[model samples]
Target: METTEWFSEDQATFGDRVAGAREAAHLTQKQLAGKIGVKLTTLRGWEDDLTEPRANKLQMLAGLLGVSMTWLLTGQGEGPTEPTEGEISPGVSDILSQIRELRVQMQDNVKKMGQLERQLRAALKE
Candidate 1:
């Protein structure tokens, strides 16, 4: 049987590790944020790679999610294992990859829009 590695440092980011661990722990973003004593937006930011948590919150997140801080930071230590065969169908996995790509594109568009809006406001003020 062939084994596939999941969430390797080269293949995944801190946000990906965080999301995977949170899901494996069966906690919603809101629930995890509450447990870690952070706002939902703050947790969302971390999961989206828009921002990172402070040291104390990072510790809390690692503990609550049952993953190592190193894994969360670098995907190099204790973390979720790869899914076994039939755990996720290829079709479903493809769909999930598409969704992640769309999310990244949307985030980029949002940043561009924010910059344009700022530029427009400055032009109006000129």
Candidate 2:
């Protein structure tokens, strides 16, 4: 699955969505906070799901991120979709698909590595 689909609201936390949207918008945490008139810590909290924005702020955030407020809250409404380069050529699209596949494989490999490490440690302790 594409990274965008992998990180769908169903699979990701509110903070994860926020971070993803922020990155898609090409804004840093500090910059987003500044644009939204919040402190960096507050933005961090939102992105970490430690806190949520109020209604007004949420509206502002949705607008700034070019997504719907509902999407931000539930990922059900209009949220950021995978960006398509202007008239994506076939070659570029194919490469993008391959990249997504590689990313999934990488994630699986990482998980397997972690499991192996844990097993190794347990065996060494025996």
lDDT of 2 by residue, 1-72 (tens): 434343445455678778878988899999999999999999999998899999999999999998888788
Regions of model 1 farther than 4 Å from truth: 1-3, 96-126
Return the top candidate by lDDT. Answer: 1
TM-score per candidate = 0.69, 0.62
Score each candidate by Cα lDDT: 0.82, 0.81
The parts of candidate 2 lying over 4 Å away from their true place are: 1-6, 84-126
In candidate 2, position 13 carries an lDDT of: 67
RMSD of each: 5.6, 5.2
1-126, model 1: which lDDT tens digit per residue? 122444546546788889999988889999999898888999999999999999998998888888889989988788865677678888867776665666567778999999999999999999
Q: Find the candidate with the highest TM-score and give its number.
A: 1
Error of 2 at 56 (Å): 0.6
